[model samples]
Target: MFMFKNLKSDLPASIVVFFVALPLCLGIALASGAPLFSGLIAGIIGGIIVGGLSGSRVGVSGPAAGLAAIVLTAIGSLGGYENFLVAVVLGGIIQLVFGFLKAGIIGYYFPSSVIKGMLTGIGIIIILKQIPHFFGYDAEPEGADSFIEASGENTFSAIFNIFDNIAVGPTVVGLISLGILLLWSNVLVKKGKFFEVIQGPLVAVAVGIIFYVVTQTNDALAISPAHLVSVPVPDSFDSFLGQFSFPNFSAITNPAIWVTAFTIALVASLETLLCVEATDKLDPEKSVTPTNRELLAQGTGNIISGLIGGLPITQVIVRSSANIQSNAKTKMSAILHGFLLLISVILIPTLLNKIPLSVLAAILLIVGYKLAKPALFAKMYKLGWKQSIPFFVTVAGIVFTDLLVGIGLGLAVGIVVILLKSYQNSHFLHIEDNSNGKHKIKMSLAEEVTFFNKGAILKELDSLPRDTYLEFDVTKTRYLDYDIIEILEDFAFKAKERNIDIKLISKRGIVENPDSFIEFFKLRPKSKISLS
Candidate 1:
């Protein structure tokens, strides 16, 4: 119903999104070491089934590059792709349960710094991974996000290796495609609606296909099949149906299948939730997506995808952003894009296959640049070290390692920052010089004083001079940790030994010359004492 509401905007936006998602689906599948069709299947389902169910207007779902590493490893660990499909189905079920249980609240707890870091990190990874493809180096699989390649080369090494193995055909196509895309984005799109509707990536892809056709006779400019889009061609409708691989129902009982299922569910849900947050932020309309409903949609999509053969699905920021930039107005754009993938694969597989990977690489390069803009880094740095440290760490961790691991590392840093701030702001202390060689010290307990402030309080209490007047204020304190209470109780005795006068204050009444600080506090729970 929502899909048909904005046909004018959604139709053209869908075309742009289709161009962006086509290669990514195949690339993510290639990186995962699965049949290329699986990624397309996921894309189709994500666009149609999930898009139909999701409350999000612009969020796009597909086989994400973020899950490529997980899928690759899980496929091997589960003994085969068939068993992995069992896990995917089970994972979908688990996600459904999570949605029903209102587990989507977990997504809100991730710090903004870490989220921004993730975006920037993914952006950096995209740029790094696509560099080889841009140069016509096809050794590494497209959509591989890790720093180290499966071919035993690191990110920097892979970039350098591209220099030694450049193919003239792809190189020329990539450069031309990049130029056309840049020009289209900057100039042509601004001039008129016709140029805007044409979409740069679509033009780039069309040019790449034409370049491939023209270069067939010229060995010097001929692009290799390995460096071109490789969607499997089916001879008949029956053959196309055969491409879909069903899960091995027998594998459902296996513990390994369940474990893999849980892993997929957890990771896929997290990635989806994070993408939902990011997509909402990027939406010019600033429309809020219902997170629980999104989880339900993703769960249902994954279940159907696995049942009929497809990779795990998540809301993907790359595709969603492309949709937004293309001026997609509704979920119709996402649904249409999915249908386009399905129709194109069935009717025009040969045509689709002719597009060079280099052109797609150029398109991704622009996407990557947009995500990891230099301005973002400057902006984060200006937010100060508290925000910048976590942001930088997240980006570095994700770029140098895998997505989950990098996020974990960044979260660890973020938690530490939070703890340090909590410790610093837990309480307040003031010292003033009074007449007659005596100092007056006032300590105010925070609204909720915890054990973290114990050390600071103890240090201050220990540094007090003999014959000093100390005032401990807890009039506004609500919840005091037992450890802090004990510290104050112990300090009262020490103050007595130093010949300091004591003035105890509380909600009940002031207690001067209290026999025991512990008993005094126990008698009147909402109170503090001062020793002079």
Candidate 2:
């Protein structure tokens, strides 16, 4: 009853997401060089099956733009689309294994900075990628996120190219659609439930269809078929069913198939886990998704999709964010959108095909703006270098490269920042009394000092002046690496020659004039050289 209770809100949001997803399914399938119908199958399976099985409340799964490159390459390298389906099924099984292994924890290892960077980067990329489509230059396939497009033109060059090739019809439709969305979101939707339930995107799409029909005979303003949502329209029900391609089990023994399978599994799992974390952050209720369960759900979705001829699937942030922005209260919104995709193909493919791609581009333009707002940059910078460095790098990386590479670059910077913090936090210095012409320095070790702290500890010990009195404190330390312990042990021996009296204080108690620290710490075996 509770799930159904949000049906009112969920139904409206589902309509928004369905419009957002339609062109993406066809474009990604086109980009992947697979049968256009396969993308729809994947979207249907992703929404219904994955939505049903997943633990995430708002995250949506479907054919991912990020995996388009891999799918394209695999389809060719594996010899054919049918053989590639074998990889998709195997990839899903691998994800299922990952779920059982509880490997979903790897998702949490990413720093908050990198995740934010990913969202922002994707946002900027969406804006950049859609500008050309908004102007009606549809050479670049929908959902193509890479800087270097499959069409030989890069993101920037593509934008410039749009000036020469822009179609007046789609551009006008795109502008009108964008204006309507802005008004609906900024004004009309707040006026009444009527506007809210009808949804801004749905209205924009409806107007776009009317615009297409009215200008059909006017060559200058008439929208070309190339600028529209090109959902494959089969002549008969049997022909539509015949579009679904099964995997070739005979290729199961092929090494290339296995390699492609593993690659897809690893990449898909990472993308899904990252999206899960992101969508959870975006969730208004702040609900933590059971990531392992998500992996299992994705695995199942991929298996079903592949068996019936679909590209690989992952939890896509674009659709998920759109769902959240649309105020979806539960996964029901996602499930319902899947049904819409299914039904639209079966019953209303003609009407659905008439909706301009530019209209959808306008919708995504808004989605992208929400993710990459200017204020987020200022906020990240205020957190200091530890956060800002990764955040900037991630944004730049995603803008110039692709999603995974950008995340990887940002993660690398985050790790370096962490290591630097660890080095500085190895120990604390306290200046006690400086009487008797011998400086007394009390060095308190940190909670957990690893080999990363070795150089800092060694430097401090080496800097001690002659006849200094050293108080080495390890009482608060829970774990000490052997490298740091050795530095201490060696320093304990050398202090005697330098007339630096050493007092070793640990959990066991104080050892005045102690010659060896290993005996007190008991962490490392006595070095044969130290004992000798």
Candidate 3:
């Protein structure tokens, strides 16, 4: 009786996400300095556990690109891989606490412009990071720490090194696999019914294995099994079961591990929160993900992943976007992808080894392009200066700094821009209230009205009609520049001269003689506070 009614609709999405996730999982592990198998384990847990419990319909979870830096640092700091595992387990506990405390609300504080900037910035990073891997560079880390480090010494330099001493076998296999993958996605799936039934990533992975096997027979192909995913195959069921590492409970008492735990929890939660927000925008159905529920799901997944020798996982936006673009219909597609991962590792271990890192790089490159295309820049620019300036600043900041820092920089700029715009338009100092017989004079402060607003204040006061009751409102103001506050205090003295009754209402309060807004807030010297 059980059946997937939307199987057809979900098929394409599953295939696309499957392809997108495969290399990301392996690359993240390689960058993290962990055994490649651990990445797959995280992928499985991310898809099955997190996917099942998520409020999101399309987002696919896995080890994140952003976490690669943290993972590398953590593995080194903890002294050993085993020690790092202990930190991960503890991290899960911290994430659970975050969910309980409703920390997901942190996503709301970010401005929309900043969020778009983050996406564009990350897209550029992905493309930059993958260039070396696509060119067959293996000596350096896949995701380097800084942009300058990428080449001449790191992954990019390693890519240059590969040109003269290119491993012919791996290079050939990688190129062939990449060709097949591209063809499958852009051609075969579109033209052939039989091929359409099969996922492009699954086929490409399959072809990669077959090529490896053919090359292995003659020893003519330079490619070796070591270059591929080196998943430890167990000879028996017990050995296979024994391969998973458990968390060291004794390490919980160590202060260093606890610190590591807290770091992981915070970073993972922030990434997950961002992913949830970004993914909702990509979903065609426009399903909004419940932030708190998503946190709980991510927390549970990380707890399990950490206990099982896996890297920390997050709801990744790229994978989620792939799922959306792929036409994923429900959560079932996500769960199926997890099962596919589980089966691939177990039954077809030999096949997975053939997947050339280059092929996966190509897939990610395409995804990166979609996220940070030139058209996106043009489109954002057309949205007006309010959107374009923030977006551009965010992109530039991220390129120069890191993700969070870049977003912060963009947000700061956006706030300042908004304040300036408001200030330029804040010439009005009063309005009329037809019903109250009281002249409701609404005064708006400039984006940054320091003592300079006193000139405007003097002008408005001089023009006040005789016997008028005035309501001086500054609620829409951003920064009540200190000068303006001083002017307000001075204006209190002239209200009687103007024959006007002045009522001040703002984020601060009615100032009889407000010295400084910041000083008022700090002093908490209450006068009269009213809200509309």
Best by lDDT: 2
User: Between which residue pairs do clashes occur in model 3?
Assistant: 13-326, 169-222, 169-223, 423-447, 450-483, 450-484, 451-483
Residue-wise C-alpha lDDT for candidate 1, range 428-486, written one tens digit per residue: 88887784667777777777777777777788778888988767776777777677778
lDDT (Cα, tens digit) per residue for candidate 3, span 208-245:
66766677766657455445654556788887787677
lDDT of 2 by residue, 384-423 (tens): 9999999999999999889999999999999999999999
RMSD of 2: 2.7
Give the candidate number with the greatest TM-score.
2
TM-score for all models, in order of appearance: 0.93, 0.97, 0.78
Off by over 4 Å in 3: 1-3, 141-196, 206-227, 422-486, 494-524
TM-score of 3: 0.78
| Runs of candidate 2 exceeding 4 Å displacement | 524-532
Better of 2 and 3 by TM-score: 2
RMSD of 1: 3.2
